[model samples]
Target: MSPVEPFSDDSPLGASGAEGVRALRVAVTRPLSGERLENLLRDAGHAPVHFPLTRIEAPSDPRPLARGARALLRGEMDVLLLTSVRAVRSLAQALETVAEGPWRRPEGLQVWVIGDATGAAAARMGLVPDRIPEHFVAEQLLEEASSWARLDGLRILFPRAAAGRSLLPETLARAGATVTLVEAYRSVDDGEEADRLVRAMGRGELDLVTLTAGSQARVLARAMRGTRPALRCAVPMVAIGPATRMAMVAAGLPEPTVAAPHTVEGVVAAVKTVAGGLQ
Candidate 1:
């Protein structure tokens, strides 16, 4: 007998297995290095395809970040919101460049993270957050933080990428908090990889496509717009969060299978469950 397939011999939705045998193929669009998502897909007997859509680049001018580091050390901001681990790592590195000794974080500083993974990243830098919003999106974080009356006079520092929407900063400002938005990095579109992904989709060599951010989903949509074949078939789009899912919908894609908790593990689990159901 042939090797037993790990994926269930199931049909698409309510269809019968004899109608068609579903083969799993996953497209990874993020700049992930580990084998975590790939391993999960392979465990479900899916073909994992990696095509990074964006690349993270450090800021050319480190002077502003260095200044921010000094301010952070002096406890200039009452609250620090860390959105991604990459940002935290970059900020820590910038701080180390100008900081002396063991590098101690500000005392009495309130830190808030979007999620557990981001919180873990902050912890790695010896900065424990005082609060972590349940929802991992900017709007949710704003809503949750806005309920605190103590934030009235607080100065919040948000270090993130140069591009992207300004909803978070705007919301915080409306809630009576002085927000200082700092750019720590930038995300550049990898046109070469985007072209490759478009080709793969056109040839029907790709199956599942995972999007971690709204910007990435939009980028993929733009790439698909120029591809002949990708514009015809409706490929499965898996989003990491509600914001990404909304972005996918806005980009003219159907509602995607959304991951809960908006973490890497959540994304993997959601993909496995959906792929297994489609098998």
Candidate 2:
């Protein structure tokens, strides 16, 4: 399956050209990746704020992660699936923290990533993915898996966020694939950051809210209640993809303006597009 199609120049949310993003205060909700987005926004002449809604941490229980890593090393697993770049780092951390001596990935084991960013993360650790969906998303990853690989009885090791979507593993299991899902990382909401966001929203200091992950959208929604005027805030949510947009709606937040290419640059273009049209 191809990646979700990117947005066109004439995106539904009015077009904000390059000049439209000038001096706009954009609140970013991504954690470790927020810096990258901030840089992009700055390049576009928009003011970017770093307000991480959640923190990605190592799992409370490390045994499952260690076991999964050991299985892959021993060639007991056929595929290693990474959903996010953070997952790749977390997996490496789990392996080093749990095992002794130098850790080496087995040669025969195939690795699959959900997107280009995750694939780049894997490559940084010397683990190149055999396949990455043309479109970056769990559903697309599953589609590619079913189309290319024989899943019946195939053992796949999936290391992902603790609260990651269940569609990939659940669907793979139904297809008779022996999938082992382990939590390599955990996403915990940062109350202090949420408070700052509440304050910003209350004073109308925030011009735009960007949600890179679905979890951040949920956290932002809860934070909204602390604001003096919740519904009237004209701040538009900028979501990186449809999944995040869905989460925003499910949480009763305003419908987000979506980024089509689903990259940081896509997000900048989305900002320009929205800001351009809203002007």
What are the root-mean-square deviations of the candidates from the true structure over C-alphas?
5.5, 7.2
Off by over 4 Å in 1: 1-23, 42-45, 228-233
Residue-wise C-alpha lDDT for candidate 1, range 36-88, written one tens digit per residue: 66666555555567777888898867777788888888888888889988789
List model 2 lDDT by residue over 19-69, tens digit each.
554356678878764467888886776667778889877798988999988
Quote model 2's TM-score: 0.88
Clashing pairs in 2: 3-135, 16-272, 16-273, 16-276
Q: Once superposed on the true structure, which residue ranges of model 2 sit more than 4 Å away at CA?
A: 1-21, 226-233
Compared with the true structure, all predictions reach lDDT values of: 0.75, 0.79
